[model samples]
Target: MQRYFIAPEQFGQHTVTITGEDAHHLLKVMRMKAGDEIMVCDGLGRSVLARLTSLEAKSAEADIIAEMETNGEPMWKVTVAQSLPKGDKLETVIQKCTEIGAAAFVPFQSERSIVQYDGKKEEKRQQRWAKIAKEAAEQAHRSIIPEVSQVMSWKQLLLRMAEFDLVLFCYEKEGAAEGSGIADVLAAFRNTHDSSREAAILLVVGPEGGFTVHEADEALAGGARLAGLGPRILRTETAAMVGLTCLMYESKEMGGA
Candidate 1:
């Protein structure tokens, strides 16, 4: 069965409505007709098995047969704070991390970051990143679509740190240091996880040359724990994916292995 992510408002009693691009895909591209079975998901973690019943020029309606279980959401929520890397690297980061169960992606400014954005470009880039996340989520069968936030300044990143239960700064300089290893931090989280409460984590990754010493100091002062990926260094795009992969693998609901 084919799958489509529909807006929450479109899901009504006994029937599901699909419009816009998705509808066009079904109507023309996929050529789906009445009686076709399709899996539909509301971005808010609700999925249903629906059968196509009617279609207009660019919209399709389906009858809700049964609601499907939403098991694609991770037990732990992770927000990846990525310093904007050069070229289309940010797209790769958002796509891969979304598939890895990252709840959101935040692009920020860093001392060593080479790429810069402003005005129209910034808005357009964010939109592109969002679209990438949506496609990735649909492909991964995720219940929730990860968000891609606007680029933030250093001050903004600091302010956002307080909102999360845990903040991990992917510091390459954190070598064999106490409380600075990713494994140590993850172990602590796994051991202390109380099912009753939700865990919101922020994973910060630096750009090409990585964070300057001053940035590292500021992050620490702002409540971020420096954590190393491993002995070998990873690129700006690769770091966040590693962080998300580890988080997903350790969480019970996200196919922990």
Candidate 2:
């Protein structure tokens, strides 16, 4: 069934109203008419089976049949802190990672980052990424839309990592012989996971040029384990997706999916 993400407010008393661009898409693009059935998600993990009751130029209203439980959200919350890359890599990462169950995307400026976002540029990028995440959530049938935060500095990113139960940094500089690899990290979590303990995973990926030695050291010192994504070097965007996908699979295997 087709799904659309709506604001929590749009979910009124037994009715789901879609306005703005979504209304246009349903009325004009999708050519949906009255009595057509569709799924509506509140973008907060609440979904509903709804049928179109009225279609107007400014809005579309649907009568909600039932509230679907929040079953799609993964048991583990995975946040991706990716260093700003060049071109449209950020957009791609946001869309793909959302589909893969990333809870949030944090764009940070690293020491080796090539792209710099200051002031207005940062705000514009955040807006674009958020839009991509929302569309991706709808496409993937996700109940919650992963957020794309404003670009921050490496230090700021590190501070934010403190909020998560486990912070993992994908260090390209980490050799294969490194004591703790990505697999090892996953194993450790799986072996020690507790339902009573609210745990969250934070994956950090560097830019195309990768992180500077000092940056990697800082992350490690800040309590993030430096794990290798194998010996092969991955591009900035690719590494982020890799880390997130692995987290989802591992979380699922550990009953956190």
Candidate 3:
């Protein structure tokens, strides 16, 4: 069945209202009629099997049948803080990371970032990134869409590090002796936090040129732990996805008993 995410307010005691683009997609694109069944999610981790009760040109309604058990969310909330890369790499990062179970995405400017931030096009770019995340989430069958934050400056990103319980700064220079292994860091974090509560983690990935020595020092000073993805160097767009996949596998979100 096709899945649609509706606002919590749109859901009543036993029915859900679909409007806007979603309604158009259902009525016109999907050609869904009354009594057709589909899956509905509140985008707040709640999902239900719903049957179409009414259909209109610009709106639709569905009756909730049964609640669904969705385990698509990861135990840890991993936020990808990626420095802007060239072209549409950021879009690829957001889309892939969302599918890999990233809780949110943060685009920031770094010292080595090839692509400069454009404030005039911020709103348009953010909207595009957000749409990518939503579509990826829907395709991945995620209960909630990952959030895409406004592009931040290096200073802003440093300050924002305080909000996370753990921040893994992906530095290319980080080697076996100097850098912390991802598995070890995550294991320690899991041991410290309560199993029942989701832990907030910030995975920082630099741009195409990667982070400068000064920037890495500043990140360490800002409470981020230097971590290496592996021996091989990864591109800016690939780093977030690899980091998130490691996290999900470590947390057994990928599959475990």
Number of the predicted model whose lDDT against the real structure is largest: 3
The Cα error of candidate 3 at residue 213, in Å, is 0.9
From the highest lDDT down, the ranking of the candidates is 3, 1, 2
lDDT of 1 by residue, 219-255 (tens): 8999888899887789888888988887776666544
In candidate 1, which residue ranges exceed 4 Å CA deviation? Answer: 176-179, 253-257
Q: For residues 1-257, what per-residue lDDT tens digits would candidate 3 score against the true structure?
A: 79888889999999999998899999999999999999999888999999999998789999999999998898899999999999999999999999999999989999888888888999999889988988888888999988898889999999999999899998877746443778777788778878788889999999988899999999999999888887888988888888889899888786775
| Clash pairs for candidate 2 | none
lDDT tens per residue, model 2, 82-173 = 88889899889999999888888888999888887778676677778888999999888889999888788998998887788889999876
Which one wins by TM-score: 1 or 2? 2
- Please provide TM-scores, in order, for all candidate models, with all chains considered together: 0.93, 0.95, 0.93
Candidate 2 regions off by >4 Å?
A: 195-198, 253-257
Give the CA lDDT, 0 to 100, for residue 81 in model 3.
96
Task: Please identify which of the two predictions, 1 or 3, would achieve the higher lDDT against the true structure.
Answer: 3
Model 1 earns a TM-score of 0.93
Candidate 2, residue 57: how far the Cα is off, in Å: 2.8
